[model samples]
Target: MGSVTVYGPPISTAVSRVLACLLEKDVDFKLVNVDMAKGQHKSPDYLKLQVLSLPSPLLLHHRTPTPSLLVLMSLILTAYADRGNKNLLGRNGGGPAERAQVEQWLEAESQSFNPPSSALVFQLAFAPRMGLPQDPAAVELNQAKLAKVLDVYERRLGESRFLARDEFSLADLAHLPNAHYICSAGKDDMLASRKNVARWWEEISTRPSWKKVVDMYSAPPA
Candidate 1:
């Protein structure tokens, strides 16, 4: 198979999530940076490839953009399971029940964790970087929402080492990018304050795949 190409800036949570998945699967891939700041993502040529044209990270294997983040990650798992990350979707060494549980947590991350975490990351981390004013009301509101979600996570983690019952599946992987930024936003207490959640976060965040993505973000531009 040709090397898969992922197009988007590393700093984008969606892009970084894909990158980390590729890494975990041990899939060989290339990253083509999209400069959102220069309006390149909205360019006519880009829109042809990605109709949504928003946080658009096109996976080149399909020769078209997979607009949904979940779809893109599912595609990666389908294409690269032999590369040895099938358990991410609970395909290897995991039964149907376990697979269902993995999906459950993936949904939880999308519906529960993502909303407030994304808001907090943007309001606290991205806004200042773009010279946009921080809305205290937004921050306060998201913080409360996120705290409630983390509370659920805290209890869940107590029962399992990772979100989907002791395995670090896509369930946990999905949260890395935004959680990283939330930590940078000085709101890591949201995770750190919860004992079980803190332990789970440390294990997943320190994985080699995610560490590589974080290093790419920290590295000086080429």
Candidate 2:
């Protein structure tokens, strides 16, 4: 626990994901805000890390990918996992196979939940920041996508409280940011209407760690 720095914009779901894990584990870490608002990700120093066999974002389809949050998740889960705290994986039968299955579902959640949800954020916040057309259609389309994702969650919740097993696991923690963001963005009724999902979210969102992140986002950015 020397110092773990997350490089990203001020209000990114990826950063918030890491913050959720840190808060859950009760780890004291520092937040090194790499202001993407000022385009620091394109700097020479940052670029050199990739060119010199460092963990740089390789150009993808001629466009670089965004800052990765998986790295942060890796760090947190690795640190937190232990023989005594094995419940985080899956108790009563958290064998290797179970962990692998848990990982798969969590990855699926990340892929499926993030795209449209983040797009919604772009419409509501980023597009306007960059002087883009945050049109009604764009917003509605992204929201529609999110509504579908929530339906999936609602179905899953009918079976269990959390996503990965009967109890909370990395998958549930991984989803909190996106789900919470959706709820906070005036989509609360949509989430609340899904009885099981609403109850599930209410329970997870109340966790001490998640509460810290929620507090930061309680006030909408002006």
Candidate 3:
């Protein structure tokens, strides 16, 4: 039981990640809705509470903007990366090592997979809702980038079956929402073409925890 304040618009992959973690741990937290649709996330109230200062990477470089998804991710790990039995992250201080590996693969997922693919889906789906037209060139670029990431995932998953070793960890949890979002945006059949990644996804997606996070709350399409 933690007084966690999750500040972000619902339906984002990041929010999904945190929600899945809370469900898995059977922990309760308050959800603050910063409707990105109405520009609430960028408003001063939300920004002061959730995005007050720069994160660890470049403390002085204020020019670099922090993504809300990344911020929520950090919050999730900080809260649930510990605790017993529900310690899905790892065991003991070993959880630390595993947690670091989780960070590694999650970074890979975000850098190599999430950005371009998400950009494409956002442009096709959310942008239009936000009064922007679909840009075909961006769509193509996103598809190409996703293809390369899938190729890498296909190989990596062929070995371990999950991002961490045999057991489930926050690493796998972190990517689930992104995977769901990407697949739901009509990339399921496309990304599923990768044998190992597809197999891996099959295993993780079935977890009861993920369903609560994924299907329970999705932002309605505008």
* Most lDDT-accurate candidate: 1
Off by over 4 Å in 1: 91-93, 220-222
Query: What lDDT tens digits, residue by residue, belong to model 1 across residues 68-177?
Result: 77788888887776886667966484688998999899889989999998998899888987899999999999899999999999998899899998778998999999
lDDT of 2: 0.66
> How many backbone collisions does model 3 have?
0
After superposition on all CA atoms, what RMSD does each candidate show versus the true structure? 1.5, 5.9, 5.6
Pairs with steric clashes in candidate 2: none
lDDT of each: 0.86, 0.66, 0.65
Candidate 3 has which clashing residue pairs, if any? none
lDDT of 1: 0.86
* Weakest lDDT window of 10 consecutive positions for candidate 2: 56-65
Best model per TM-score: 1
What TM-score goes with each of the models? 0.94, 0.77, 0.77
Q: Estimate, for each residue in 40-121, the C-alpha lDDT of model 2 and write its tens digit.
A: 6677765553434323222211122233456546555565555223455567437897687678778777688778877777
> What value does the lDDT take at residue 205 in candidate 3?
93
Show pairs that collide, candidate 1: none
